[model samples]
Target: MKQDNEAVGAQEESFSGDESQSLVPDANYQEEFSWFSVILPFLFPALGGLLFGYDIGATSGANISLQSPELSGISWFNLSAVQLGLVVSGSLYGALLGSLLVYPIADFLGTEEEGTYHCSCTIPSWGLITAYAPDLGVLLVGRLLYGLGIGLAMHGAPLYIAETCPSKIRGTLVSLKELFIVLGILLGYFVGSFQINVVGGGYMYGVSAPIALLMGIGMWLLPPSPRWLLLRAVQGKGSIQELKEKASFALSKLRGRPPGDNVSERQIEDTLISLKSSYADQESEGSFLEVFQGPSLKAFIIGGGLVLFQQITGQPSVLYYAGPILQSAGFSAASDATRVSVVIGLFKLLMTWIAVLKVDDLGRRPLLIGGVGGIALSLFLLSAYYKFLGGFPLVAVASLLLYVGCYQISFGPISWLMVSEIFPIRTRGRGISLAVLTNFGSNAIVTFAFYPLKEFLGAENLFLLFGGIALLSLLFVMLLVPETKGLSLEEIESKILK
Candidate 1:
């Protein structure tokens, strides 16, 4: 009884000691600038998504802008569907190559000290990185290379941010990628339409490429993911003090302390050691295939299926071709239709911000089900309007806008947050990459098929197809995916798989 009392006293002392230690200094950033810190990390993930949005939006919009005299001299005008496919899928194909190639580069390019601990294990060693051979005959080789970078950054960035940041801000931060996606779409639509009547030079007239370039360069300024550093150090048993400082900066922000608090040599060593013991074989770790081994398999299915659901809603079809879509419904001219599409993109951006603000309070499953369910109902109504009334194109357009609003509030940003949270640290990068690649592939299929579907089944049936898919996705989310809002990655992994 005396010995038990002594042990209990020691445990109490340790708990009290940590609790008494201030979470922050006198000048706590979290107290004064809490909102900014919450919103800022969210922006980082979106940087890559923004580029993706631009590439997607620009291809169609830029193509339309190129038909005039200013662009008539440019060779891009004579491009065929194969060429168009190259232009459209350039970023996606780059993403695919990057997705496969990142494992090796992330695995072997850097030692355990460079904030890429798992790189030594997760990456495969073939030169599949060059699968995006610049000589693919597209004139936009630079854009393709840029796309490769975007793919790498997009896959790695969110995982890095999600792992490093505290549980308090994780959802908001991951959702930022979604915001950037919407922003990029808006920016692309705006830039592409700016001088639509100006001909060739007009399409190339503005800062789309420059903006993408600037954004890519800007990402370098953000801190390397701390988890990457800890994982790397686990392999070599050597500490990288610089990497530790970066990790400290991130943790400091989360704990409401200074940028370097809890970042001492002892802390670094402890973190690395814990990660090493937890992951067991960092090299044989994080493969897309490995996610199916045990609990990870369930997590993978949830992550991949959620993303697949996000795509099946036909949201991309509405987004990618909103201009022509509105024009088809007899809205003003093509130019006006494009302008309205830009407005819709803006609306998406606005709604996404609302999501960031409220996601934690509202919870993930609720928003997801509500968003998809609402959109499904709206799509069905729009189909009815189109079938019954000749002048119901405006109704269709209004319903589409509402659908974007629903998606923006729910699956648009929530899916990314949920995927980032669900996977454990060991398989995080590969798991999320698989989700992203699945999203892109499904997006590509949906984007390509929508036109053919409309052509074959007519507009009414096309919407019915989307409505049914949305309803099915909603049911799946309710039945399978549990709510993950406000949970830490560790808590989520342990609770979810169990």
Candidate 2:
């Protein structure tokens, strides 16, 4: 251990002496851009996000179908409003459990392997169970299992994308995960529209099974994160030379370069030194408590706060209950409401694309502040329509559309993107897991409480409260969130976190 400390000290001195090279591996070296290189790695991991979105979209219609008299023959089909909320929000509670479960084990498991486990195991199991379930108890169990997969996937996917992809396009790629999420939602709405009349919504719950199986198979073809390999090495998983050899190979695969590439070799050395320096003061790898101290605490504040606001402002509740909300707003027929949800889904998809294209170019804070302000305005408009203009249902529809569009641009994508960006790599897994736990925890609360709250406060008052939260969120972004447009992860830690 003493000798290891000496070697790390020497490497740090060599790293600091080099004035031309920045701490970020990508900052010092520029590889020729390859769309294939970038997109191939991103595609499989993003399926995790798609599954998350599909759950939201499919459940929206399922909520409607469960209320139909056709299935009322099932013993447990006739549910109270509170029981119905539990049925709707079951996966979210499971997601909260999944996030907590993964926190301590994330570093040990690594992101790539976690993806494979969730996709192959939890996701498919839930689909099969939910599809064939004959009772409400069985259905809730299946949804809870599925939520466990979502918790794992959501935590791993963004971290994998951010760490492996080129920094220049980091924001764009991470934001694209949001694109997949909305795409899944759109696909779910389409499926729900066709299957709304089908008893039990079996096909709707079963759709993700085959896709998840394929994604699990595809995950085997992708390389593990290079940074994760180096981190493990620093934790004494292997020798220094082994760390170099393994990390260099992973970097070559990620960057579409030859195994013997000199640039990849240099990056491995630099990253190792950086990792060592981060661990210099510690006796072991970062503990969960480490996430609460100093720089990691700051990251948690920003990342956690964003995700908290993301849910408390009511995005999940709106999407999960879209069919019911629209029906209440004047599209009395379930079919009409599901069709309108498709339109809303399409507009959301389009708006997310704008963020995907512009996140790297326009920076983070401006988009967040602007888009959140729009969200607040739309929420207030929704409240006004419900309160005083109940006669005009079109106003409610327009306001709902505006709310969905604005959220797609800002809070929907940016919140996750920033969470993946803000943490130091050493404690990144724990930090992000905690943030996601907060997210799903908040989501479960809002979703489960929606019906009761709507009944108690009325739709207008509920929306007005959400609008007030949105205004507070906008203020939080302006004052606290920093612009992370183009910085590399190491640069973010050394510069921004400091």
Candidate 3:
């Protein structure tokens, strides 16, 4: 009996060693990645995408009601563009706050120490907020705080997904996060449309905000990443098995695992040890500042510039003010514009779904080329519509929908996917954060400036400018963006440097 027990122990040790080797195996990680392994890592990050999309789209729908002529007397619309900008930028402000604090929070929440969070659900308890209660001032404050909450949640989601996932499916998973983001937008638009059409626009706000809160609360169903669990869970602090159980539950939705069957104790221990070792290797990889100091310049340029080009696509311009843009083009009032914009949102959701499904099979560059080409074509037609016919309202409308579809299928998902793929694991969180921040910063800038630019440049020139940028982006992708369809993170990293 003693001999039998000893043999079992030996087999476990051997399994651990083999798993460890697999974690940083010297050669091609691409060939080894499987679907089961790739999908589970995306669960939380995808939720972050959902939150971003939902919150942003919810606002678009809610804005129509918020800014309606009937409610113009309300304090919400009493403020100037600066104040409204503050309100509109409130979430981004929260996101910035969250971004500032995410690393530490992730360290604390995700770390295995005794006081740290061992379960995913614990975060919402910390993030519990009441942004929509009474006063306009209170609601604004709450919204800013909610943005921070989302910011805190958003940073961790993609970082976790990128690091935990293998490269073969990394692009797909990262893109899934973006897809969920678009989904949230579509859902918010759909829900808001129904609410606004049925009741007043303010009712739309009333309906959507609480829904976000409820979803935030639902996050607890998943386990802490097993990587976080074994590496950071305190001794007697968290049941590794509990984390595994919860992770199995959370991961089940993404990968179709039965609640408890997906993760085992041995798998938890192995992944954790692998992450710890990977973390150690990461420590020596390079400093975030130092990452861009030397031979990494080419990569830094690509990563940074790609994000900039992503914004230049004029996608957010369409999203943030789609209804307004449509209305300006003669679509009726803001409410009708929103209803039509929802159709655009639906197109975005469907195309994004297509992108996610085919990204692995179709390859990144082709999608990007196709997307950029489509954006140029759509924008050119749109500019002509605006220039020739007082923005031939109907054509403007159709072009906008096509623009959204083109973006979702190409730049939207691939941008995030490539950002994750292009950077090294050691600097991945920081690198991806830099890329995401650039994305938001550019988004905020363009969003605020689009109105002004349209005022100054006129609608035709505004789109032409974006179309020109899209052309430049096409050139950039053709020249620099590497084909990363089947490569693992490490393999991609090696090839990029070589």
Candidate 4:
């Protein structure tokens, strides 16, 4: 322990004179900022979020399409309730499997390569397979493959965005990932509306294929994360001086500065010292066991808990079955229900934009706590409409919109944002992989059980249970989650984790 402290001290002492001054932002540094450079890198990684959202939106309509007799010419296409649940949740189960598979390999691959591989490979493959599947088994295989990509994208995008962005704008950039997801959902809804009667939902399933291929190509054009380069240096992938040169080049590009500029060089040197200090007392690479000890353990508890609640409070089930849920609330026509979903998607996009604007300014806790409080209230309103106000269909619609809007501001984006922020550099990859695993595992369970649970508990009682969970989530944020707005990754590790 004493030796560890000494190592940290030595690392800190390496920064001197102008190098130390670079740690504090100056007017010239502010003037050098290029929004286009920063936003360009962020845009490619965020397409992963779009893929996840498109699946959610397209599947909602696909569920309705699969129920029609036109597609039921195949004996198995006329699915029982249990079989239908499996079809709707097949991707989620695949996502669960994908998260477990990615846990050990996350550190080795890094986020950029992971994003590129999954987009270029998994997404297009799933789209083609699902679009032309001959039977239930084939369709399900396609869903699982698509879901595998979602798990990878969901794990990598936020972490990449968080690491590459300037700290002052980090919250906004990271939150834009959720914005892309919402846009995808909206796009999916529009396509589903047009393709609802198409045989076997082929058009709906195939639409994202070309777009995902384009995104994969774009990923190749962006710079790698500077922090990831530094991590490779710490892991002894190459000589320290050689890796530092590469890291400096990447950082200069990200900061929109000339590589040889004095300010850029000082900033890179300061970043290196901060990263080394963060890693000083730990092993060059982190192990699964190490993640459960001390500060990493605390980070897991916070990150894991947020993701757990994010699903259990019922966001996935609500979005996944929105068309049917709206139908039950008295939009009797299937087309009318899908149209309502598009409107709801638009509201969700707007709400996520509000969060992107306010997150760095208002801090994480306020949005989490306040939005959760609203979520609980919305759930209760839904329960009331189902139980005693059955005649008032509009009340249920209003409550559902409220729930989606509140969630956009709270658990929807913030949970992933916090997960990206909390872990130490060494264990961040595995730590976040575990959190994503927890997220998908719970989502699969909740989504698969939504039909049965609603049947058993009734819509009123199930919503009430979700309302209770939302209240508990609100309490969790108030008591345990810290405000991380405006802090650098190194500062967060030293102050919050310690």
The alpha-carbon RMSD values of the candidates against the true structure, listed in the order shown, are 7.2, 4.1, 7.4, 3.5
Q: Candidate 2, clashing residue pairs?
A: none
Per-residue lDDT tens digits of candidate 1, residues 1-498?
A: 343333322222111112111233453333223555544444544555676676556554654544333544454455454454455555555555566666556644321122221121112110122212223353345444545555566676675555444444445566777877788788877766664555442233234444434443444444454555555555564566666666557445633456665433334445544454454534634555687777678888888888898888887677766666676678645467667778888888899999998888889888888888888987887688668854767786778688989999878888877787677555656677777778777776676566667778987898888899999998889999988766644456567775
Error of 4 at 83 (Å): 1.9
**For each candidate, what is the lDDT?**
0.60, 0.81, 0.61, 0.79
How well is each residue in 256-284 modelled by candidate 3, as lDDT tens digits?
44544423334445554444444442342
Task: Kindly provide the TM-score of model 4 when superposed on the true structure, using C-alpha atoms.
Answer: 0.90
List runs of model 3 lying over 4 Å from the truth: 1-45, 71-79, 111-139, 162-171, 197-200, 230-286, 294-297
Q: What is the lDDT of residue 223 in candidate 3?
A: 41
* Whole-model lDDT, model 2: 0.81
Stronger candidate by lDDT (2 vs 4): 2
Cα TM-score of candidate 1: 0.78
- Backbone clashes in candidate 3 total 8
Per-residue lDDT over 1-498 for candidate 4, one digit per residue giving the tens place of the 0 to 100 score: 544544443332222112333455563543346888888778888888888888889888888887777742355567777777888888888888878877877767877877887785555556688877778888888888888888887887877777677655666677788899999888888887777766666557788887788778877777676667766787778788887787677766876888856765666676677657667666787667988998899999999999999999988878988888888889877678888999999999999999988887898998999999999999999899989988999998999899999999988889888987788655777888899899999999998898889989999999999999999988888899999987755567778988
Which of candidates 1 and 4 reaches a greater lDDT?
Answer: 4
lDDT at residue 106 of model 2 (Cα atoms): 83
lDDT of candidate model 3 versus the reference: 0.61
Name the best candidate (by lDDT). Answer: 2
